[model samples]
Target: MTTSSSYPDIDAQADLMVYLVLSQLLMRHLTGRWLTVQHVVESTHLWLLTNGGSVDWLQRISLGSRAQELAEEVAQIEGITFDVRTLEAAFSGYQHLNHRSPAVAAIYGACVAFVVERRTAGSRTGSEK
Candidate 1:
């Protein structure tokens, strides 16, 4: 289903986006094929450990069929241009500076940056400036 506005809904689905991107990244590191539960789990753990985030969040999550379903949906959202590798790099570096993994926050930040910049660029008046 399409969302109210691509921007806000993309923000809402940020978590799934990150996980999906992580899935792709992990796939590249692993077998370079389809993602499985093991791939998701390993990716999640690796991201947490290397990014210096607590592993406690894993307790509340399950990298099962449902996650794969959500990931597919989020990854297919129209008009969203995400470079999974670029996001991976940015997310990795962001953690070093902030002392925490950006996690879904990275997705939200990118959306915000895009919307703000787009609005400013397309504005007819200097009010947006």
Candidate 2:
């Protein structure tokens, strides 16, 4: 996955990349973790009450298996360096933010920010710059 020439199939690759990232986040939220379905819903309601964010629902989406497949695809594609742990942390912050949990967002935001800035900054400057 050299970051040299542009991938001709970027559109398809990007779609897969997005799914891979999103799925990892979902898995972290679900899968017998700290956040249960009830907790997730409660968090959503709390977030809505606190902030005017249009976060209506928080249902468990079935994408764990599929996300695993997408992750493999993303790995096969060149020039893509998104890590599942990074996505998981970003998603944690996003969910917490939706619930008006600034503290949680701050904690997770640091991890997400690091990965995002690292990837985008490379694009802004030359890869080796």
The candidate that achieves the highest lDDT relative to the unseen native structure: 1
Model 2 RMSD, rounded to 1 decimal = 13.7
Clash totals in order: 0, 3
The model with the greatest TM-score is 1
* lDDT (CA) per prediction: 0.44, 0.37
lDDT of 2 at 115: 35
TM-score of each: 0.40, 0.25
What digit string (tens of lDDT, one per residue) describes model 1 on residues 9-87? 2232233335545455435445546576676666566555554443234221422334454444444555544355443
RMSD of each: 12.4, 13.7
Give candidate 2 misplaced runs (Cα > 4 Å): 1-33, 55-108, 111-129
